[model samples]
Target: MTNTKTNYLFFTGKGGVGKTSLACATAVEMVDAGKVVLLVSTDPASNLKDVLESPVDENIKAIKGTNNLFAINIDPENSAEEYRNRVTQPLEGVASKGEIKKVREDLSGACTTEIASFDEFSRFVSGETEGTEFDVIVFDTAPTGHTLRLLELPAAWSSFTEENPEGASCLGPTSALKSGKERYHTVVNRLRDGSLTSFYIVARADKASLKEASRTSNELKELGMGNQQLYINGVFKAIDKQDSLANEIEAKGSEQLKSIPGNLNELPIRTFPLLPYNILGIDKLRSLFNPDLQKSISESTVAQTNTPHQELTGIEKLAEELCENQQHGLIMTMGKGGVGKTIAASAIAVLLAKKGHEVLLTTTDPAAHIQDFIQQLGELPATLQVERIDPKVETQRYTEKVLEHKGQGQSEEAKKLILEDLKSPCTEEVAVFHAFSKAISMAKRKFVIMDTAPTGHTLLLLDTAGSYHRDIMRNNMNAGRLRTPYMSLQDQELSKIILVSLPETTPMREAGSLQDDLKRAGIKPYAWLINQSLTLLSSITDPLLKSRASAEAEVINTIKTSYSEKTFGIPFIADTRLLPTLLGNKEKV
Candidate 1:
C-alpha cells in the first residue's frame, strides 16, 4: 500500500480502461492518509472536471472535501499558447515584426504543441512546482501511443541535441534547452529510478487492452524504466444463475484473465471486481483503494425507482437515412479508443453496401481492428472493399518517392541530412496525411467509410492536414490545387463525421471535446452514436445490470440535451451475430 504512493505515480493504459477513476481514487486515499498530494491530467481530452464533479482548469485548486489534495488540467492549447509566447518574447527587441510573426507561426504547429505540452510535463516531474509542498504527484496520462511518445521524448531530445547542437530540428533550436538540460536530465533519472518514481499499467480483462498494456510495458522497459505494476479493472462475476448475459460476461472476463500476455505474468498484478454502481464522487472513489471497503463494495447496489428509461433511436434509423439519400461521400467514425468506432464503421459500411452502393471501408489507425469486424460479420457485400494505410509501409514508400523526385539535384551532404530528417516521427505523420488525402478523393465516386485512430492520434493527423493545406495555399496559390483534403473535409455535405461514445462520464466529455475540435477545424459532425448502451438492454434484471442501466440513462439524457441533434443508442448484446437484424437489414453476405 505504501509503495502505491510513490513520489511520482503515472496511470497509463489504453483509453477507457478506468485510468482516471483509479488515479483519482488513489489520490483521495493518500490525502485521507494525511499526505499532501497533487493530481494532474495531461490528456488533451481530459475528464478531470467530470470526475471531480467540479470545474478544473489549468491552475491547481484544492479539492473541496480533501484535506491536502490539489488538482490541475494541463490543456494543450493553453500550454502551446504560453509556450509560444515564452519562446518568442525575448526576440521582440532583436528581430523584425515579420520575423517574429514567422517564428510564432512555426511554433504554432502540431509538433510544437506536443513538444510544448511535454515541456510542462518535464518541469512538473522535475520538481518545478512553486510550492514544493506536496509529498506525491499523480498523473493520469493519455492513450498508449501518445503516452509512449511522451515517455520517449527526453531520449529523443537528447539524441537530437547531441547530433545537431548548432542547428534546430522539428522542435526548435538546441540552444532553447541550454538552461533546462540539467532539469530534464534529473526528470529522466527520476522516471527510470524505481525508488523515485512508479509506473502503473492499468488495463481491463479484455484481450485487446491486455495486449496493449503488455506492449506498453515492454516499450517502457526498453526506455530504461522497467519497474512497473499492473491493475486489471472491471473483472466480472455472475451472482444470478438465470442471468444469461451476466454469465456470459463473467465467462469472457475469466477467459481473458487466464490468457493475459505471458510477459506481464512476472509483474505484480491486482484485479478489481466490477462494482454495482458507477464510481463517482469522493466516497465511491476512495472506497476503491481501501481493501476492507472493496470486500463489501460489490454487494452495494443501486435502489431502483418507478421512473422508466427513455427510448432513444438506434443505428437502424441512421442506416435507413443513408440508404434513402443514396449519396456518395465520406463517413468517418471517431472518438476515444476502445469505444466501438470500428464496429460502428463496419456496420454502416455493411448497410450501405447491402443497399447496392460502392463503399470502401479503410482505416488509418496503426492498430486497426477492421479485419476482426469483418471476421465477425463472416463476409462482406460485393460492393464493399476494405483497406488500411499501414504507417510503416507508407512511410517507407513516401521517403523513397521524395528521394527520387525531390532530391534528384541536391548535394551529397544535403541528401544525407534530408535522409536523416526523413527518419523522424514527423515524417511518418506527413506520409499518413497524404495517404488520408488520397482516401478522401475516393469519396467523390463512392462512399468512403474511415475508422480513424484514437482521439489524440486522430487529432494530430488532422492537425497535419491543416498544416499541409496552409503550405499548399501559401506556395501554390492556384485555385485548382488549393482545394485539398482538408477543404473537402470541411464541406458539410461531402463529409459526415459520426462520433461514437460510451455511456460514461469520461467518454462523453471526450466525445464532446472531439466534436468541438472538429467544429474548430471548420467541420461539423452528422450525429452522435452512443454505443453498447445498457439502458437499451432492458431485459437484464440483475441488480448489477440494473444499476448500470440506471446510471447509463442519466448520461444518455445529458447527451441528448447538450450535444448533437441526432443521437442514437446501440443496445448491449451478448452475441454480435444479431447486428444485421438489429440494423433492419437481413441481407447476408
Candidate 2:
C-alpha cells in the first residue's frame, strides 16, 4: 500500500456493510506506513470515536494507536448555525431586528443543515481548510443515497445561486438569490479541481449491495466525479469441518461474489476477510489490518466446508402473524439512510402482494430505489401500487403555500424570510409528516407498506407528529385551512412497523433504537427482517467468511427474541440482480 499521497478517500455503501470499519482500517494502514491521516465520519450516528476507542468530538483529535492519525465528526447542526450567523450578519443593516430573527429561524431548516455539512466536507476534501498537510484523509459516509445527495449539493447550490445571485448574502430568499451563486461556485470549483479526491464504494458480497454499488458508480461517473474504487468488505468463503454454519455462509458468499453485477466487474476490487471478533476498537482492527493475519485468515477460510441450510422458521412465523389479522394493516420499514430498508420494505410488500393482498408500497426516502426494483420485476400483478414521497418537492410546495397564506399583504422582505425558513431542516419534518399522514390514511383503505427516513430523521418526524396534530386541530378550530390531508395518518392499529437490519452489530443496534423510537411514538414494530445472511445457506471452506457467518446466528436469534412475534432472514443471493424467475409470478411464498 502506497502512503506517500494526500488523496481524499471516501467510503460509502449500503448501511451496515462495514464502511466505517473499512475506512478506519484504511486510515490505520496509512498511519502505520508513516503517513499523516485524518479520519472523519459524516454519518450522524458515526461510531468512529468508538471504533478508534478515542474521545472524538466535532474537532480533530489524535488517535490513540497511531502517531499521525486524527479523527473528527462533522456535526451539521453546528455548521448550519455558523452558516446562518454569517449569512445574517450583513442583513442586520438592511432589515429590522424582528425581521432578522424570522430570517434566522427560517434559515435554520433542513436544507441549510445539509448545505452546511456539505460545505464543511468540501473544505476538508479540497484541502482548503486546516489539516491539509495530512498525507491522507478518509471519510466514513452514511448510506449510498444520502451520501450521493450530500455530494450533489454543490450542484444544487450552484443552481440556487444562479437563480438568485444578489440575495445569496442576505438573510432571506432575495439576498440568498443575489449572493448564493458565488458561494456555491467557490465550493464547486474547489471540488472539480481536487485531483487528490477518491471514492471507494464499499459493499457486501450480496446481490442487493453489489447492484447498488454498480448503480452508484454509474451515477457518479455521469456526474463527472468518477475517481472511484470498489471494496467488497466481508467476503466469507468457509472454515473448519466442525463449523457447519461457517461453511454454509462461505458457500453462499462465494456464489454471490462470482455473480457480481456486470457493471462493477471491471472496477479495481479489493476483498477483506470477515474477522473472527468484532471490529470495534483500534486493537482489534489492527489485528485484522495486519497483512499476516489477513493472509492466514484467507487461507483458513478457503480450506473449510460442510455448511447447513438455514431455517426460515422466523420469517414463516412472522408471515403467519401478518396473515392472521386479515384486516387491512400497514407495514413500514424504517431506519438510517442506505440500510437496505427500501429493499427490505419492497420485499415485504411483494411478499404480501403475492399472497393476494391489496398492497400499496410507498416510500418517503429521498433516494427511492424501489421503483427500479419494481420496474425490474417486469409485469407484475397490479395488486401493488408503488408511490414515492419526495421530501424536497413536498417541502417546497408547502413553503410556497405558507408564504402565500401568511404573507398576503406583507413586504417582499417578509415573504423572502418565510421562504428561507421553509428551507430549514424543520421543513423536511413538516413535509415528511404530510406524506406520512397521507400514507397512514391509505391504511384505512388498503394494506399500506412504507419505507421511512433514517433513524434520527424518522424519530424527529414522529415527534413532530403529535405537535403537528395539535397545531392542526387548533388551526381548524380557528378557521385556518384544515391540516394537509397527509398529517393525520398515525393510527397504531392501521400501522405495523417493520425494522430492517443486517445480522451485524451496527445495524442491529440501530434497528433496536428504531424500535424504541417507534414505541416512544406509540408505534410498535410488527416484525424485524434480517437481510442478507450467509448462515442460512449451505456451508463452504473459507475461514474468513466461516467465522463471520457463524457469528450471525447469535445475532439472528437475538433479533428473533427481541423485536416481534416473529423474525425473518433473507439469505445472501448468488447474483446481485434479481432475475424474473426469482420474483416469482405466483407469489405465494
* Candidate that would win on TM-score: 1
Cα lDDT tens digits for candidate 2, 138-232: 89987776787777777766665555544432224434222345556665664454366677898988766787898888877766666677899
Model 1 lDDT tens row, 181-240: 676678788999988788889999887789889988999999998889899998978767
Alpha-carbon TM-score of each model against the true structure: 0.92, 0.75
TM-score of 1: 0.92
Candidate 2 yields a Cα-based lDDT of 0.68
lDDT of each: 0.80, 0.68
Q: Against the true structure, what is every candidate's RMSD?
A: 3.0, 6.1
